[model samples]
Target: MTTDILTVSCPSKRGIVATISSYLASQGCSISDSSQFDDVETGTFFMRVSFISEEGKPLSEIAEGFTRIGAEWNMNFEFHDSTTRMKVILMVSRFGHCLNDILYRWKIGMLPIDIVGVVSNHFNYQHLVLSHNLPFHHIKVTKDNKAEAEAELMAIIERTQAELIVLARYMQVLSDELCRRMPGRVINIHHSFLPGFKGAKPYHQAHKRGVKLIGATAHYVTAELDEGPIIDQETIAVTHAQSADDYVSIGRDVESRTLARAIHAHIHHRVFVNGDRTIVFPASPDSYAADRVG
Candidate 1:
């Protein structure tokens, strides 16, 4: 069975669903899983549909047939073959928790992505990345060579034709120019205690304040720093009995899981960026199933 995904975003109006359903039926496609949302505030509609080509229609033909419907609705849409894995680039620094977790998932077939390479500002994880038989690029950055370093990073992205960049606990601050160039294509993970716990050692700060909740946030990378549109978040309960080191341990676990979930959503095409916010659809059936339990 050939599984394909269709994502559509356009102004909210009548008959959008009917038109889409009718077109898919005409193309001999059976809708297996579908999710749609109409934002009343913004008058925008988002939909994600997973279908099987019952009549064995080629994707090119099916997509060609949908162009008229797309034009009629003034839609922004894409037809993606679910079997095709998206190419992704992972960036990291000293932190290895999120990096290690993602690598494990990818190795186990949990994350359906083609990791083009791993980029780091330091050599901390060079051996870790290489052990997986993956290419690793060590591009050290400093105050004076930040621009040059980013240029080399861009060169890697272009050469590999990476579709997404995952900053898995990368410590460097990306330049505004890079943010603007990529827009919603970059994702980053960090501790969720923003504003409340600024600067270094956020978990320590939270412990100092006797906070009861520790969490992590995964979001798109933008020029405004950590203020990008959120994609996924998670929290763990803490107690006064726990030490700051305990908080750090719990926080790292949360960060790793949150980042993986966010990346999963992105690679599956379930995330739709709308203005400063996002509308993330639920996963299609069996989309999260790993090839192996390990």
Candidate 2:
């Protein structure tokens, strides 16, 4: 049996589920797990269906068969084979908390992705990434050569055929041009909770404000600074007894957790962009189950 995941987004209407199930059944598929959402406020519908092809139909054939249903319902849909892993490029700067966490999860099969390459403006993590047998690109970026550096980075992305870019605490602000080109393909992890404390040293800002809660946000990269469609967010309670360094320690854990969860949804095709927000469905059964490594 071959498992394939189907994702759909369209205007809200009746019989969407019936149409999808009926179509999949016609393709000799049986739904093993399914999730759907009807956003009344946005007047849109989103769904994720995990099904097994009992007759062993190829992904292309199954997808081709859904065209008519897709057209009739004006739906945006994609069929992904469970065995296919998404190619990704990870970018990071000084902070290695998020990068290290992602590496561990990827190695353990909790996060399923092919990390094709790691790009960094600094050479801090060259040995770390190289130890994992992954290609590491050190393309230093400075104010004087920002454009040239980005060109080099683009070349690496193209050469690697990377489908997604994960900015795991990369401090450099991406130019508007790159953000426009990639649109939904780029994901960034911000230390702050977002729309609250943005920009450099967000932990310090939060500490100064004397807030009781500190959080992190993982969102799609946009031209605006730290303002994008939020995919996942996490917060931790803080007290005046904790120092600024303590806040930093707590923030690091949340940042790693939030970013990992967002990427999990994205790579699994369980996330959809909805205007200024996102619709992230629950993970399929056994998604977080890991294959232990020695």
Name the top TM-score candidate.
1
Error of 1 at 256 (Å): 0.5
> Tens-digit lDDT track for model 1 on 1-294?
867889999999999999998899988999988999999999999999988899999998999989988998999999998888899999999889999999999988999799999999999999999999999999989999999999999999999999999999888999999999999899999776455885689999999999999999899999997999999989889999999999999999999999999999998889999999999997778475422354
How far is 170's C-alpha from truth in model 2 (Å)?
0.1
Q: Write the per-residue lDDT of candidate 2 for residues 1-294, one digit (tens) a residue.
A: 656789999999999999999988988889989999999998999999999889888889989989988999999999888778899999999999999999999988888899999999889999999999999999888899999999999999899999899999999999999999898889999898846677768888888999999998899999997788999999899999998999999999999999999899899887899998898898886344322245
Per-candidate TM-score against the hidden true structure: 0.97, 0.96
Candidate with maximal lDDT: 1
- What are the lDDT figures for the candidates, one per model? 0.91, 0.90
